[model samples]
Target chain A: MKLKEEIINKLQARGVELSDIAEVAYHLQKPYSKDLKLEDCLVAVKHVLEKREVQYTVLTGIALDILVEEEKVEGALAKIIREDEPLYGVDESLALAIANIYGSVGFTSFGYLDKDKMGIMKELDTTKEQVNTFLDDLVAGVASAASAKIAHQNKNKELDEAEIS
Target chain B: MKLKEEIINKLQARGVELSDIAEVAYHLQKPYSKDLKLEDCLVAVKHVLEKREVQYTVLTGIALDILVEEEKVEGALAKIIREDEPLYGVDESLALAIANIYGSVGFTSFGYLDKDKMGIMKELDTTKEQVNTFLDDLVAGVASAASAKIAHQNKNKELDEAEIS
Candidate 1:
């Protein structure tokens, strides 16, 4: 069987770049630590991306978005997705399902990130080039997972400092 | 149309009490402000319950959980749900989707509450009276939404205080 990393890499080769996902991680953690590196965020983002469920969410949402961009899918579904109906929230539902894979931390972070639309997310929402139905939540997942990862790692450091002092 | 509070009261008649829901709200806001009341949290919880999507999620999840408890749903899906399969994270997905109505704050709070199982959540999970398959996430959504609500409210309060100074 192919390794999980190899699987994620193949998916990245398709369209979703790991770097774009990593950029969100950079934004989420930069406020806390100036020394934060993209690689650090990439590690956490990749960890979440490696999950089978996340992979499925990423591919499905992007494919639909791509089809909408190309004007392939037609009729009611396309209209809803393209317009992003306020009440018809299944689009957000699918994206949130992907975000939930990382744990509850993904939920609230996904909410704020969705609202604020920062970094690559900012680009995704603003870009006239493509319909990014899944990109925002996918990016939010990466950012939330990375934030949880950093918080978990820092928790121990904080405990150690407390003991020393 | 029935008022939102009335619709919520109907749900309460089904065994899930508003007071129990409000208790979760209290827990969520208490961390931020000791002076926060159960009524304030109830207002926030009620606001979330007003959403059509949130209402649907709560009802569907609880119904399924109840069906399983009564052995009405006898099949593979029942087995999976009753067992809460490791890979079958959709249950949490539906629950988290409800939580997402508020935003990112729900994510982490839901995670912690799901793990720790404190307050009313603890009772629901451990109850022998009925299977609470969905209550965990539902309650978490209540608490998380309330947390996000208080956080949002507090943000404005903080700004007001800053201006006052």
Candidate 2:
């Protein structure tokens, strides 16, 4: 399958609902523009997912989770990857690293989502399901990137896609 | 002096100009609004400077720089903080941590500034007069935070200073 589809499928397996993620997109975009719809948020997020950085982060996060679960990586690193020790933020940093592709705004968004535990994020944190130490911020990065993309695109009424680069 | 001025003063001591930092702010907000003024960017940055997180980062970046300059912090960390070692991103993480206060938008702004090396950022990168190992991303964080602050404020005409919380 395509990278974006694989990324989404991995997230879905971990319980991240696209609609709920779109809700996050809506929250971010609604503050700036009233015309933004949930669909717009989804479109923006999908576009952000295409960025190589975003794809790398998705795969990295998933791989890290698997490594931790199988006890393949351990010791100090395992403690951080598995338990997500509050002070040892390697996981959060790694997840935010993906978000970093979009910008500092993703830092803020990831910080907020990590703090607020909103929507599906709350579920992903403590389900009897798979370990998702990275899912929360990973999703936050996606939504934040999507939000930035939408804002950038809407900046000009007549500016063509070429201008965005 | 007031907290904002104090933060600026601290950054200034590190060789970052208020004008140069404001240039970073302007680059971030200009795309969103044609009405953005340098003074507006300054005001927004000043407000961001008020945050305890931002204050802490300003001081921390300075401290790290001093540590590097004096050869006070060595080992792997010193390599990362002192030279901003290409892949050793601990320093960048410190800067982005400050940007986290604003939102994902700040991440986007920081990423852009880091990538583009525009305006004062270009100058800050190499002015043999001072050691600026951590200066680049720190400046980006400041600019990005300032940018996010402006965007958050402009989202609603009626959003009072009281509502910023």
Candidate 3:
């Protein structure tokens, strides 16, 4: 299945807004790429998930369910999660393996943003009334990984220019 | 008093290692022109701290204390904490602050070393002991900031060269 379609199905299963799925996927995908736009990264994530034969929808649904149950994805997302919600754990590392194809930098960014920027935390924080303590570390990870990516990109650019000259 | 000396004293009083004091200060100081050596940054930080009258040592010391008390410092340093502890909470950020004076690339090396190179975390993990989580962020921050400093220094150098030429 197409990654986007897969993500959509997963979100649909999880009772997340059809609109929220794209935004969530985009957040998950963005810190991983500097060369790619947010949409491209999202699309790429979808691609990698499919290539790996991942049940992306199932995995994402489970993750969302856990987040909701644990009050990590509270408010609107929580309201949607039903007793019939799938039973599974999100092997985020597996999902990240798909992103690592882009680079470790992407993986780190994914981890960071996942922890910090997903807005689910904010949603969870206000609605579930839980603290987003994990967010700061996640932000730091993204930043640290991004720094590596930035340096690597700069070095690669230097090499490319050198070759061109 | 010179900023370097002030910072060093504060750090020592706060229980920072003598070895790390100057490097931390170097990382925290303003950019030096062209020179990328630790010494150059140390000198620059000392100079700037003096000029600005900023008590960087005190500031850094407090930050270190917070991170340490939070159990954020890890890896080799964490091992050091378990044995022959020079002090607690003198972390990657302090080290990076020292590096930041030199350039951005310098901190990359530190972060790279902190993650892949440091063997302490593996051992600590196996032992089920808490390794410093904050260290990695500090290292990353130092590298990121240093990269910024290097860019700034490069710009200044180019301007100076252009003016002279």
Candidate 4:
């Protein structure tokens, strides 16, 4: 498997979503990786996922599940799940959740990606329209998550080096 | 037509997904509004759908559209549009995208609803598995979007009142 996919699978196996993994992958791919490690990235992802600031993704997910159980929205989410709606609309939220892990800077980066559709998404050229908006959010979530992750990693790394001294 | 159905048809007519409307409905009924007017709710719904914060949903939807066009995620999101798959995993990014709108609070609420499976989602029991994780993300997106919608409405109302003054 490709490195990105490998990372994605590893995270997913740990209960992280593909989008979150992709967000981390994208962030790690930047020059920042020169100063970070895989463990750092893992911690960053964990921090954002559990942080209070960006918990809306988890909250919304729960609510949607409830709606589905109640057979609300013509069982729309259920229908989407049951019939597997071809052009699903949930990708944007997934992407944003990852980005929100970082911070507002992540939001800025997300805006750029959504407008640009850089990398793999642009190549897809699918009729699905929410790509820019949702991807922007996803990128932001990833960035936010990474920001916290990076900070935590730096703190721990510094402490570790000090201890080694 | 039932209130929920009416909302669903309106969303479908506008090319919005049933889940999207269902999500809006979820917020429309809860803490956000004790006696929410359909028209007012519609306004809030449109606000979120049109707001840049909610763009993540749009972007994910578009990606799934592309994936469906290319035949990826065969049993999940891609199939939902084609009306073929029995169950489709929602694109992870989409859910996150929506959650980012309301920050982490909304995302957490989504998770709670998904895990509990209360309200409209109860109808989905016979049709599919519990889908706690996926639903959590979806609910986060919806709630975040709804929060943004509510925020926008409050802002607009404030602006209108200010103008009258």
Could you say which candidate leads in lDDT? Answer: 2
Docking class of 4: incorrect
Each prediction's RMSD to truth: 12.9, 15.2, 14.7, 11.2
Off by over 4 Å in 4: A1-157, B1-35, B51-93, B99-105, B128-140, B151-165
Model 1 chain B poorest 10 in a row by lDDT: B83-92
- Model 1 TM-score relative to the real fold: 0.52
- Tens digit per residue, CA lDDT, model 2, B1-165: 876677677777776777788888897788777898999887777777778877877777777777787888868776655555433455567778766576655654565566568877788777766667677778888887888787777765544755876
lDDT (0 to 1) per candidate: 0.69, 0.72, 0.40, 0.46
Could you give candidate 3's per-residue lDDT for residues B104-140 as a string of tens digits?
5566656654555333323322342333333333333
Model number 4 iRMSD: 12.4
**Cα misplacement distance, residue A24 of candidate 3 (Å):** 4.6
Give one digit per residue, the lDDT tens place, for model 2 in A1-165: 988899888878777767778888788668777888999888877777788777887889888887788889958887666776533455566667665565544554565566557677777787745667777767877776677667666754435755766
Better of 1 and 4 by DockQ: 4
Off by over 4 Å in 1: A1-165, B1-14, B163-165
lDDT minimum window of 10 residues, candidate 1 chain A = A7-16
C-alpha positional error of residue B136 in candidate 4 after TM-score superposition, expressed in Å = 9.0
The first chain of model 1 has a TM-score of 0.78
Measured on C-alpha atoms, candidate 4 has an lDDT of: 0.46
Q: What is the two-chain DockQ of model 1? A: 0.05
What DockQ do you compute for every candidate structure?
A: 0.05, 0.04, 0.01, 0.12
| Worst lDDT 10-window in candidate 2 chain A | A84-93
Higher TM-score: candidate 3 or 4? Answer: 4
